[model samples]
Structures are given as structure tokens and as C-alpha cells.
Target: MTLDAPHAASRPTTSDELRAIALEQFASVGFAGTSLQQIADAAGFSKSSVLYHFASKEALLQDVITPAIDQLEVMLDRFAGASDPAKGRARFVDDFIDFLLRYRLEVHTFINQGQSLRGIPVIDRAGRLIVRLSETLCDETASTEDRLRLGIALGGAAYTLVAGATFFEDEIAPADEIRTALLTVVTELLAPVTVATGPRTDRNQKA
Candidate 1:
């Protein structure tokens, strides 16, 4: 899924153009498998021209996923300071789904890149976002068991998004309904527990 080359005397390739082509290549062939030559060919530019804008393949990848990661961080910050927790939660769910869809290939790029970006600031930011989200799913009163469950639920949500993308090539947006269903499940799981009957056991005590 590469774009056609610009006609003769067309403007020189912009950084944005290189990034876009690199993103498509990385998402398609994976970061490890993609090469600068591929990106240059796809964008109809010399390899050195691609290098002119980006220092290396890793730098280009960092640019590719940085926007999505930045958006995630902004969403987390907004939700953290939101005045109405209920509305915030609902809105965050909707926006998060939107982000996942808008950056479907970008998300795939990051996932397929594996640990190549390890220790990078982008990865740190993403990790912090996940932790914040896990804490958001629980509260000060939430038990350790409850927190663990919340983490599992969030992981399940990510897995479902990737799986849905793999299964439905032409219908990425429609697959968000899967997240909506998973959100319902998360709400139920995060709700406060109530003991309905009988004496509480040792397991319950620990929980």
C-alpha cells in the first residue's frame, strides 16, 4: 500500500512524506524487516534523500509512533484532571477507541517492532500511561486482587484491538464495537463487590 511517485519537477519530499511512507513500510514489513531503500523506492526518492530527513531507521520509527504515544499521554492527563469521573470515564473510553482506530497501523508498527525501542522515552511514556490507566480503573479502596483484575482487563482490551485488526482488514472502524463490549465488561468488573451471603472465607479475607 505505497503511494505513487510525484510527477517530474514535483516538490522535494517533505519530512512528513518520508514519515508517512516509512510508517506504511514499517507497519507492513515490520521495523526489523523494512529498509531505508524500501522507503526511498516507495516514496520515489534517493536513499540519501530519505537519510537527509531522518538520521536512521530508528529515528524514523520514533517519529512514526511518537504522535500516537503523545496523544495517549495527553488523553491520560486530561482524564486525570477531569472534574466528573463518570463522564470522564465514558469519554475516555470513546476517545481511546478512536485513537486505536485512527492509529491502527501505527499501533501495529509499535507492536511489531517488539523491544527495539526499549528504554526510549516514548516507551517510558507509554508505560506510565498504562500504569495510570490501571490505577484509574481502581481506587484507594481497591484491593490488590481488584487491581490485578483491572490490569488483566486492560491487557485483554489491547489484545482484542490487535486481533480485530488482524481479522478485519477493510473494517477497522467497525471493529470498535468490540471495545465497546469490552468496556461494558470492564465496568462490571471494576464495580464494588458485595457479599450476598454466608461467612466470608480466608480467601475472601485476603482479598
Candidate 2:
């Protein structure tokens, strides 16, 4: 799941550059497989230099993913008080898709490597956020079917984007196309099911 490295011409600050490199490696090779030395080598910095900017590999990982986690918190808070389930579900689908696209690699890292890195505070926090997200979408009284619908809709979107990126590689569809397809599919999944009534009988006319 390796993405192309950031362009060298962009002059981000040292900490930002290191964070970008670490994120790329973390997403490409699972966090356990990646090392601080590897990130340093890729970024053309010494191990000590990497440490100077980030206290440790864990800290670097935190720096790489903190922004996404922060945004997730904000989105969760906004949807927590949603008074209308139907409208809230629709709004959540829209907002969620945007969030997934905006933080594709970060989501990839969390989805793929989060469990293995569970003891880490940031990873644990991310996991809690995901649970909170599910609760926000479906409350205590939500049906099993509704919960399944929400799970499939949200989980499928994340898997499609993250795994789809690796699967398609160079031939991946454009972002707008992907986003539209996800919205269409997820919206259908979350849509309320309608039961049709049988045709009326003319009791007075035909006996």
C-alpha cells in the first residue's frame, strides 16, 4: 500500500516533512514493520535528527495521525446531538465520505495497523472514537438490521477507499468518481426499507 513520496520541491518545516515521511512508511508497511531508522533514511535525516524533532517513533506516529483524530472528534461531536435520524444519517454519510477521502492514508494506517498498536494511547483513542461514531449513528434502541446497515455502509466505504487504492494503484478512479460511487452505494444501504401492500379487493362488486 505504498503511496508516492511527497515532492521534494515543497518546502514544509522539518517536523512536517518528517511526519509526512513517517506516515507514508506507516501506511505502506505496517507500523510494526517500519522503524525510526527507516523513516530517517527515507527522509535523508539521521536517527538523532529524527529524534530531535520527535521524541520517539511513537511520538512521530502520534504527530502523523493527530490531525485526523482531532477532526474525527469534531465530526463526532457535531453528529452526537442530531435530532433527526434520517437527516443525521444522510449528513453523516456525506461528512464521513469527505473525511475518509481527506485522510485516506491516515485512515489506512488506523484501519490496518491500529489493532496491533492498541496499547499506544493515540491508537486506543482512535479506537474509542470509532466506537463513539457507531453509537452516534445507531443508538441503544437501533435494530440489528439498522446496525448492520450502518456498519456495512461505513466499513465498506473505508475498505473500498483504503484497500481500493492499493488494488487499483495507478489505474484508480478519480477522487470525485470514487466519492460519487461511495455516496450512491452507502446512501442506498442506509435508505429506509419500504414494504408494499397488496392490491385492494373490490368486495362489493364481485362476489
Candidate 3:
């Protein structure tokens, strides 16, 4: 949930600070509700300075979320190459938990505001990426139950992290603890169920 510590006290550049502030505002207040001036004020920079770094509010949003989207693309690419479904499922769960934790605010912003911001190129691309992820994770051959399981596992994890942060506030467990718990639950949810291969015996049938 928290960013890694900087090497030095002042290593973060102005742009980096601006993007972080924008991300928090975008997540806390819906994108439609947040203004460039607000971000400028929060970052202690003039509105003109904010504009100098990012052309517009939309551009600033793009700067804030683009890295998360790019990393998602990489995760999808690696998942595609995985030949073992069981292993791949485990790996994907781990990767997804890390992704959600790393980009918690970004995920929160998009999940809550994506529909309203749909026309933006990056938002549209994010939507498509989500669809592709669903498809890649749950293939056509998977049953409805399987698809539902995939949906619940992934969607539940995202919602839990994003919403739980606010819902629990200070009472929430540490990020490492939450990550481990999510990995365990989601991995189990996606795990393949074992079925008996023996001939069926109906209770209604005569022996």
C-alpha cells in the first residue's frame, strides 16, 4: 500500500510528487470531482507549474496510471507463455496480488471511475485489457462455474484491497499480511477441483 522508501530524503522529483498527489486525489475523490488546482495545491506547486509538468488534468491522469497498465500488459504476456495451467494459475495469483498492492490507488481510481471516463484512450485501453485478462485467464473451454470462479476470485481481490483500505482504515492488517491472505484465498478459489472418474451410481436406480 505504501511506496518504497526513497534512497535520499529528496530523491523524488517534482513530477513524481505531482503524480503521487494526483493519484491519491483521483482515488479518494472520483476523477470527475478532483481538479488540477486541487492537485497543484496539495503538491505545493503553482497551477502553472503543474500544467508545465502535465499538459492537462487528463494528461496528468495518464501519467499516473500508465505505468500500472503497462505492467499489466507485461503480466499478461508472461501468463500467455505459461504451459502448465496449475502452475500458471498459482503464478498469476501471486502476480495479481502484487499488482493490486503496488497499484492499489490506481486500481481503486479506475474501478470506481472507469465507466465515467470511458472515452479517454487510456481508460478505453484499460477496459479492453481487463476483458483480455478475463479471456486469457478463463478460456472458452472452461465451464460457467469455472468462469464465475475466475471472476469472483479476481474481482473480489481487487474490491477487497481497494475498498477494504477505506473500510478498515487504521484497523486494516499490514500489507504483507493482507497480501499473504489474499494469495492463499484466491489461489484456493482458482484451484482445480478433483472429480471422481469411477462409474456413477444413481440412488434412484435399482441395483
Q: Among these predicted structures, which one has the highest TM-score?
A: 3
TM-scores, all candidates, are 0.65, 0.79, 0.81
lDDT tens digits, residue span 1-207, model 1? 335544534754578789988887877677778899999999989999999989998788888888998888888888888899888877777687677667766766554444575666665566666667777756566666776666555555454555665767554554557557755776666554632245435775665
Question: Order the candidates by TM-score, highest first — what do you get?
Answer: 3, 2, 1
Deviation in Å, model 2, residue 84 alpha carbon:
3.2
Position 192, candidate 3: lDDT: 47
lDDT of 2 at 155: 63
Q: Candidate 2 — number of clashing residue pairs? A: 0
Tens-place lDDT per residue, model 2, 1-207, is 334455544658888889989988998787999999999999999999999999999998888898999999988777766898667767877887899888878887886677799999989899899888777766665666777787677666666676775677764687789889877887787664542246545679776
Of candidates 3 and 1, the better by lDDT: 3
List of clashing residue pairs for candidate 3: none
Where does the lowest 10-residue lDDT sum fall in candidate 1? 192-201
Model 2 misplaced stretches (Cα beyond 4 Å): 1-10, 143-149, 190-207
lDDT of 3 by residue, 91-153 (tens): 887998899889988877776678899988888888888889878866655555666777677
* Comparing 1 and 2 on TM-score, the stronger one: 2
